[model samples]
Target: MKKVKRTTIYDIAEKLGITASSVSRALNNSNQVNEKTKELIIKTADELNYKRNTLASNLRKGQSKTIGVVIPRINQNFFSNVIAGIEEVTYQKGYSLIICQSDEDHDKEIQCVNTLINQHVDCIVISVSADGNDYQHLQNVLDHGIQLIQVDRVAEELETLKVINDNVQASYEAVSHLIEGGYKRIALLEGPQNLSIFKQRKEGYLKAFKAYNVPVIEELIVENAWTKELGAEGTRKLLSLPHPPDAIFASTSDFSALGVLDVANAMGIKVPSQLGICGYANESFSEITSPSITTIDQFSVYMGNTVANLFFQEIGNNDTITKPKIISIKPELIIRGSTKRNG
Candidate 1:
């Protein structure tokens, strides 16, 4: 099959008996061009199906009007909502977005960043995956002179515009909530400690214990139990101990908390009576659980909007927003039946 050749500005200009420069200026809506002539040129260009080459235009302008976003998993609700928020703000500014997922692999994350760089994206937004450990890939982004924004799960060492929740403060509040409800022995279903988010959450739990004068039990804490299966396994191990925890904080996510709730039910432990459970991320299923789990609402969508607007503000104002700026959004704890111990 023969390929259809795309029409160009030169073709339109020849057909209209005008210079290619005039056609180009008209297509770009330049004010220097006469309104009537510009309209005529545009009409002729449209008739000829002249489509401007964005790459050539961007090269001439010295920057692409495209932003690349990298996420661990695009299918997750939180990340998808964040992407939606980013699109809402970026599309209105006549910018394009390119999305890619790392699938929780460090190598893939590195590859994704390199691909974005090759594409000449003006900015790159990312939330590092759970398995990512190296920083060279991230450093390469900054070294290339492109704007980089890190959101949610981020690299702690890199100094960039970071839109993140107040993980420590929020976790402290969640732990304190359980204490106020008279749950003394609390078990933590912790995530990978390498991530700053999980470490901060652990800090909050410790701080709350110190504040309330409750003893922190090492035996009650489980490390690297981030998924539902891990949560369930950790819960089983903890409950089988001589003295089981009266409450569990699924700091990894709500899905982990759901695992705790299921295990507790199977063991005939009454929720909010014999066992209290809390989770993170405010996942939709948290509300629909048999006994709704108390969780932290990270305001993922709002965070995305904040990130997109931050890029625009820095780029539009030409300000020196140097020194790896960090913006922390406070997260709210949603109290539900799972953590309500008494009337």
Candidate 2:
């Protein structure tokens, strides 16, 4: 196929018998160009099918007006909702987004961040991957003088703008609710302890037990059970114990909670009567299950909006020594049939 050349400002200027600079200024809507000449240039450019070189133009302004986002999974409801919220705010500001998924791999997360840095993005927003233990790549982003915003999962050592949920309080409330339901022995399905969110959740669980004077059983707590299959496996192990728990809290996610419910059903264990279940992150399926799941609502979309707004607000400030700010949104506990044993 024969190549067709793209029309440029110079071509439009030649057609209008004017300088290329005039055409450039007119195309950019610069007031330096008079109305009459601007109209003529625009008309000629339209006739020539001229398209402005946005990349070149943005480079001159010292910014791409683009933000890069790195997330663990793009298809997950919570992350997708967060992306939608970011788009809602960024779109109105004439900024574009470059979204990349790490798929919960640390290496891929690093690659995504490096790619964003190479793109000269004005800012980078990220929810770190599960396997991430090193943050030198994230530090590289700051070394290049680009704005970095961490949301949800974050690297605690770095001092940057962060938006996160009050995981500890949310988990505390969930466990307290289970205890209040007269469930004496409760099991816990926990995520990777390397992540701060999971560690904080565990803290909440322990705190709840202390507050109620309930003895904490070490055997009932299962680690690395953030996935559905893992949760199910954990549940089976817990149920097989000589003294089984009456309640289970899947503090990792609703998917994990669903796994617990599935295993209980297969084992002929009735929920809220013989067993109780609670989950984190109020996934869509949580409410539609046989017995609706008691879960925490993270307001993921609102968190995304807050992340973008924080970026914009910080970018506008001229102070170079701005201290890192952290904004924590409180998650709400939604009571449902899964844990409503008394009612």
Candidate 3:
């Protein structure tokens, strides 16, 4: 199939028998151009279906007036809400967004970042992929003088603007709640330790155990159980142990916790009484489950808004040298039936 050429000011100029500069001036509503010529140029532009090159225009002014956002997945509730929040602010500020999803692949994430960079976007906001161990692409954004903002999952070594949840504290609260609820022999389904967020969450879980004087059982912790399928697999193994845990914490996400619940129900294990469950990231389905899962509300939408606001605030500053800023939002632990044994 042949590509259709986009109509430009030059095409309008050629059709109207006028200079391209005059056509450009008229299209931009310049006062120098007479009303008659402007009217004619606009009419011709409409006929030709001419669209203004906003990116080129903004680039001439040393900006693109556009932001690029990269996420692991587009369908996740938390990510979609965050995108909505970002769009809300960016639209109001007359800025557009170019969204890309890495599908949790490290290579795809790098490609997305490079594409955004080549587009000459003014800012790049990213929640790094799970499998990404190298961050040269992120550093390249900074090298190219593009404003970079890391949200949710991030590489801690880079001194860039970041908006994140207090994962450690949130995890601590979740685990502490389980301990207080008389659920001993608790198990943890943890995500990949390569990411700082997951590492922080593990730290919090350990802290809670220390606070309560609960002996940490190394055998009860499952690694890389961040997804629903992995969570279910881990749950099966845990339940099959000689001394199965009475409670399980899916520290990765609500989806993982849902997996735990599914496995428990299948085995006829009663929630809260025989097996308690807790999850991170208060996904919408968490509240609607038969036995509503106890989870942490990350305030994902608010986090997105905060990231945009931070970009605007930092860009407005005229300082030659700026220190990296980190904003941590405290997540709320919502207690539900999944862990409410006494209730």
Candidate 4:
């Protein structure tokens, strides 16, 4: 097959009987070229299907005008919403984004960062995977003089720009709501403790019980119950105990809470009456579930918008000086049928 040649400024210049330098200035909208000549050059360039090489153009300005985003899963509602939010602002700022999914693998996360660095992306926004123990990949980004931002799940040890949800407070509110609804025995389906967010959520659960003077049942608290299958298994085990919990806080995700609800149905237990369910992330299906689940709304899209806007505000001005910044968004409790035992 014959290769189609890309249209360049030289081609436009040759068609117009002018030097390539004049065409370059006209395309760049530099004041050195007159308006009439610029108009003619643009028109001819458009007719020739000319497209500016953004990679080369950004190199000249010492910027890529591009951002790299790394998330665990693109199909998940929370991460996808965040990406949409980032794109909304980046699009208007004349920037582009290169997105990657680590699939919750540490090695893949490192590879994604290295790829972004090699591409010379101006900034990198990441939500570390569950296995992201060593943060040398992030340090490498800083060493290369690239801006780094962490969202959702961040490494607290690293000082960088971060936009995250207040997991502790949110979990506190969710558990507190269950307690207020007159639940004495509340079980917690927790995530991996290594991740800061899960640890904070566990802290919040414990704090709520402490505040209420309620003794925590050690058997009720399950570890690594982050997935639907695990949540179902945990629920079965908890419900089978001699002194079973009347409420469960699936603090890991709505998906886990969903598993609890499914198992409860199969076991002939009623939600909010026999057992209340509260989940995190307030996934869309939470509202549609029978006896819709009570959950915490993380404002995922707003979090994403905040990340993008923060980058533009801090770095878009071309200021060399920058300081470590942290923005924490407060999540709200959406009390639905699953946890409304009293009302």
Please give, for residues 1-343, the per-residue lDDT of candidate 2 as tens digits.
9999999887887777888898889888999999998898888888888887776789799999999999999877899989999999999999999999999999999999999999899999999999959999999999999999999999999999999999999999999999988999999999999899999999999999999999999999999999999999999999999999999999999989999999999999999899999999888899999899999999999999999999899988899797899999999999999998767
lDDT tens digits by residue: candidate 1, 1-343:
9999999988988998888888888888999899999988988877878888997898689988999999988877788889989998999998899999999898999999999999999999999988957888889999999999999998888888899999999999999999999888999999888899999999999999999999989999999888889999999999999999999999999989988998999989999899999999988889999899999999989988999999998887755655667889999999999988774
- Most TM-score-accurate candidate: 3
**Model 3 lDDT per residue over 250-285, tens place:** 999999999999999999999989999999888999
Cα shift from native, residue 82, model 4 (Å): 1.3
Runs of candidate 1 exceeding 4 Å displacement: 1-5, 10-26, 29-41, 319-321
lDDT of 2 at 183: 94
* Local distance difference test scores for all models: 0.91, 0.93, 0.95, 0.93
Q: Tens digit of lDDT per residue, candidate 4, span 203-271?
A: 999999999999989999999999889999999999999999999999999989999999999999988
Candidate 4 off by > 4 Å: 1-3, 13-22, 30-43, 316-322
Please report, as a residue range, the 10-residue window in candidate 4 with the lowest summed lDDT.
Answer: 314-323
Q: For model 4, what is the error of residue 133's alpha carbon versus the real structure, in angstroms, after optimal superposition?
A: 0.8
What's the lDDT of the predicted structure labeled candidate 2? 0.93
Better of 2 and 3 by lDDT: 3
- Candidate 3 Cα misplacement greater than 4 A, ranges: 1-5
lDDT of 4: 0.93
